[model samples]
Target: MSDAQFVQIVGAVYEHSPWVAERVVSQRPFASAEALRSAMRRAVQQAGEAQQIKLVRAHPELAGTAAARGEMTAASTSEQGGAGLNQLTPEELARLQSLNARYSEKFGFPFVMAVRGHDRQAIFAAMTQRLNNDRDTELRNSLEQIDRVVSFRLNDLISG
Candidate 1:
């Protein structure tokens, strides 16, 4: 596939960063979808700290202002909705807001996770557990989470 079409398919895998897919497209005809995913993850990982931080920060908060305004990208809207984040009651929304605010303040970005298989309670528990981590640890964990999210997205787009 051409770079443009390739980016369209994989761009949302990294939140709003199509450039991640754009960079990987040159290494086309991946032996397997997994190989393509690894290259995408590595591109972000090998980036300077500033770039990595920006990539992480590009993600919207769960039920955040973007969600409130219905401004999330299609991929994010689906992911958040599938996690039942879009179904929270007022009290739960408040709880998430509090946790999100604190997490972003402490870590300099939204809490990152592959929430596809998790419920609200589980996500909350993770947020609480991860809040105590040092900055370096949290940043690394965020990248890992990004990798998992991308993997899920790739599976949808590629059979292998």
Candidate 2:
């Protein structure tokens, strides 16, 4: 795709995911690929509380439940279930489910991650580790990670 088409797709994606709308729209007509990436990182860094919440909500749940409903991307769904969250055997699934339930209940949302290349055990460990964070810090970190994931995905979409 040309730069203009890339801009359009990025803009639409930002709008579709409201969390990134203002940032994506505001940084239109990027002069270089690096500039576009920098803008995205800055957008996430400067995102307000509401935008952050929207971003978190846009991500699939930790156990891949929301993903199966088409609310999340197919690639994310597969990654979450097939690897990062998938290593749990039935017993382990139950244990992780308990942990996930507790974590979400504490945070008011499901645990979110960009699990493109993670294994289930690794994700599980990360989940446990992240649960140690206070709500504010974890929320910020999670959204930043989501923005990174989206940016990478956008680059792929545009390049292809």
Instruction: Judging by lDDT against the true structure, name the best candidate.
Output: 1
Candidate 1 Cα outliers beyond 4 Å, as residue runs: none
In the order shown, the candidates' Cα RMSDs to the true structure are 1.4, 3.4
Q: Write the residue-wise lDDT of candidate 1 on 28-146 in tens digits.
A: 88999889888988899888889999999998898899999999877788888999999999999999999999999999999989889898999999999999999999999999998
lDDT of 2 by residue, 1-160 (tens): 5545555566443424633544565556779766776777677667777766776766666665654355655556555666646456777777777877877888876677776777777777888898899999888777767765676566766687
Candidate 1 residue 80 C-alpha distance from true site, Å: 1.3
How many residue pairs clash per model? Answer: 0, 3
Range of the 10 consecutive residues with the lowest summed lDDT in candidate 2: 12-21
* Cα deviation of 134, candidate 2, in Å: 0.8
Instruction: Tell me the whole-model lDDT of each prediction, alpha carbons only.
Output: 0.89, 0.67
